[model samples]
Target chain A: MGGKVTCTLGEVKNRADFIVYWGGNPAECHPRHFTKYTLMQKSPFLPRGRKDRTMVLVDIRETKSAKASNIFLQVRPGKDFELITLLRAMIKDQPISEAQVAETGLTIEQLQDFVSRMKAAKYGVFFFGMGLSMTRGKHMNSAALLTLAAEMNAFTKFVAMPMRGHGNVTGADVIMRWQTGYPFGISFNRGYPRYNPGEFSTVDVLVRGDTDCAFIIGADPGATMPQPAIDHLAKVPTIVLDPHVTHTSKLARVHITTAPAGISAPGTAYRMDEIPLPLRPALKSPYPSDEEVVRRIKEALLEKPDWMGERPQMLQNQI
Target chain B: MDLKVIDHATCTFCGCVCDDIQLHADDERIHQAKKACVLGKAWFLNHTAERKYPDALIDGKEATVDEAIAAAAEHLYQADMPLVYGMSNTTCEAQRECVEMADHLGGLLDSHTSL
Candidate 1:
């Protein structure tokens, strides 16, 4: 009752009749999302393509993607959780006052119509974005959306997926889950992987100044992270591996130029739907690939004495 | 006007990772990226094979990749709590290496997803 119910983009393209874009603007942030993967593609189930599908966009403000949606619901800023909760209750046929729904800036009638459409659709999908996951209530907002998608399955096929941005972040998540049995925010202090979000998350770790040294690759945290976190990275001995001299590279103690992924580095990258794709490089680069540099760093570390002198190689259970 | 064309080239600017892009490139840079959106085109055309920066830099001074690698390893090895962060733009193979480095260093590992 409380797990993620989702499918690959192909399934979404072929089967989804009701598409709800929550807190995401595909038009600008992800330009090819609508045309390539979701709304425009014609499948046997949805032969008419755009005509056969219903796209509802829910966000705090109107964006270019709204032009493609059949309906645009602008929820009050920071009220996504309230609106989602109200919908959850309404879907269960529970009595809810219009005043409560009004606080979310959407009329009860609109929500009722939305619920009916969700129930009637052959396949429904909720593509939530950073606007939901990184906003007020954070993970709770995402969990609510996922829960709603899971509950909708009682009446029809429904699923939810995060509109993951940045190159190969989903790849990193999938790989971390495979290697450490955790997605992100991992700590290896005990000779085993431990998962903790607030405690081990990069921002929190840097803000807290808990880490002594940092090894960065592919991302420029100096430009993105909070000021305190940025300050801490500058204070520490940071090593950066990137294609360009990025913001983080400027602050780092050491910067190694690595070939850019998907452009000049050949390897595997995962799409937002966790679909693995082969990266074909179009140009040759003077720098080494990230994989080669990281492997070299790992090998350099291995040549030194083991920090972990005597400990169990594996643990049956992690605390 | 002769340019090398790569079909089925994937655009990694965003999560969609559209793999049907056709990239027309020369020895230095990509001249055209067909079937790519505005963002994808910028992503593909912005980077080049040219060595825009030094091969490696230490304390803001130019250095060899080997020296930088050794410096990075020494710094990470000497720390009590080293951190391995940022895998959003790299390949999965490199990500695996980062994770392995964290495990070996008994450090914290995180990604842009955490932000």
Candidate 2:
């Protein structure tokens, strides 16, 4: 269940029949996405592009993408899992209770239509965001979506991917997976990758006051994280690397200024659509790049062999 | 000694991060950029506006870069617990340094959500 595989967005596009944008507004967040890659872009199989593909937008509000979508399912706030379950029932041709429809604020007709579209599609893809993962459900919401996708595969092809916001968040996940066999919420305290979201995740670690040291990369939880996480962050030994001063930088113990990604540093960032794009530095900065720092840490880890170890069996056992 | 032109680069102003761009430079200054969106254009043309020198607050006063770095290092070394944040706008290189320092000091670190 835990392994690494390399594939292209083109392959995913070829296999997908329906693309569902859930809890993410690609239009506002990724302006050129539809024009460059997802819907309107020209592809070998989808010669007609947007016309040849089915686009559905699932959000809490009616967004610009929803306005342009062929199907828009506006689920109530924090009701994503419930809606997914109801849709699952619909896919199975089972009757859904009116109470479930009322709870989700989606009419029976709307639910029926969404389920019909999902069933009719030859292949389907769900691109979800933090809106679903950061809310009441967190990882369980992701698990539910993945489970739904897995179930859908019995009738038609379906897959799900998180709409990672950072430029290299996917890269971080990829790196961690390659090195530790876990994506995130990784622990080195026991000398291996110990995967526990609530226990080892950045927020959990900070909230519980379990960590004494924190090394942050291309991410900022100060401005975005919940108040509890922020409060916890205020009490930690923090180091910041950024071009501009931010809330986190203001609280940093050691602030190292550097150039912006894709502007002053060259690296690879996974786009919202899970496409790997090269970031080219247009200018130079006095400080080193994140890659250099990670390389140094890796060298240090190599020198201190005890700090690095084989993947812990606990994660597999939990699974 | 002479000016140079580069092609196929990404713009860093906004989330778009448009990669198709050309840069024209002469000696020490970038004269013009082509095929850049409005945000990218402003970013390239206003390169001089970007800050190079670093400053620090010593007793709530602006101090030299060295003073700031020293103060920051001292603060980190002395603090029982600290939080390091913001890397969305910076290069990964700086992020690496910040991360190392956090690990050494056992601090909390994070970056911008939009970057």
Candidate 3:
């Protein structure tokens, strides 16, 4: 969970056997994700990649991925826990009651089928999105998925990664993790990294009106947050980095223009599948990249020690 | 009708904001779209969805973009507190503009979570 590893998309293609898309619609969000890296593309080992590999889609709706999946499991909204539990039960070969099956809207047979497929895969990768981690169950959903993947390892190989949307969101998470032992939902006020998802999560923090100053980088929250959160954001001191006039840009205070990664600035980004790729900027823009802004922030923090606090060596290592 | 081709157009449909789409136009009509998804195709092809362009309204009657921008700016500026919102559906450039306005006006800015 806390280490630096570098690999190319070609390597990922060579290693992966099963690709699971959890709570993501690559077709709708990342139109070229599949064409460039995953499903439809040809890989080194998997010359007939789409045919050689198993593609699983786990979402609430019958999405485009589901329509094209070798295995599509539709979980009821906010009922991911029940579905995970059912999968766990099936993995254990324990008898599942009809009532439990009905609760998940999935028959025991279907659950067993999924469990068997998951268990049999040579290498399974679960790519979950905010849909699984930011909803009613929140982190619990992620925890369950991680736990299931951990459980699966008893029989085979498995890994889980979040399908971060912002071009540099995974980069942000990596930076935060490297700096503070925590990914998102972090607080620098206390001078150390504190991991409290619900308490420190962006939504809860804004909705609770806890943060007075916010530095928003490549990401925008104003247009994507709930009304309550948005209402709260309108009152805080915010720093924005973007290139155009957006709902969030309209609200920013110190707006620092930045070029879009992959289009205007070259950088590394983790695809929705957790495979890191080098983004080749197709065009140039006048703005700087978020990386530069963050580097400046780091310099500023170094100048003002009060902005950050002392931490244990173990915690520092974790970060 | 004469035909024209446009390259590197942005899709105004989803948050993906797929900007590499190409459009074939015949007069005022868009004949076809390429490099877009099902949702994007529908959005670009269909022009009869009540027309959410030019003038927008908060409650009924039409209002100019200037009026809306001013009203929104005043409402945000005047508030002892204000929340600057919505970013997932627009381009990253627009998001930057929003963040600057928020900071300048001392407001909170958050992205709307559609997921």
| Candidates by TM-score, descending order | 1, 2, 3
DockQ of each: 0.78, 0.21, 0.06
* Total clashes for model 2: 26
Taking the tens digit of each residue's C-alpha lDDT, what string does model 3 give over B19-95?
56777765344657789677667655653212223232322234543343343443334444343333432233333
User: How does each model score on lDDT?
Assistant: 0.92, 0.60, 0.57
Superposed Cα deviation of residue B65, candidate 2 (Å): 9.4
Model 3 regions more than 4 Å off: A2-12, A41-48, A266-284, A288-319, B1-115
| TM-score of chain A, cand. 2 | 0.84
Better of 1 and 2 by lDDT: 1
Tens digits of per-residue lDDT, candidate 1, B1-115, equal: 4589999999889999999999999999999999999999999989988889999999999999999999999999999999999999999988888888888888999999889
Sliding window of 10 residues with minimal summed lDDT for model 1 chain B: B96-105
- lDDT (Cα, tens digit) per residue for candidate 2, span A1-319: 2321222445555555578888888776655555654677656777777787788888899988886578888889999989888887878888878998899988998887777778888767887777777677866787788888878877877777666554555544443454446555544444233566555556666777775544454556678778887776666656554555557666655555545566556776544333545765555555555555444443443343232235333222321
Which predicted model would earn the best TM-score?
1
Candidate with best lDDT:
1
Best candidate (score: DockQ): 1
* lDDT score for candidate 3 against the true structure: 0.57
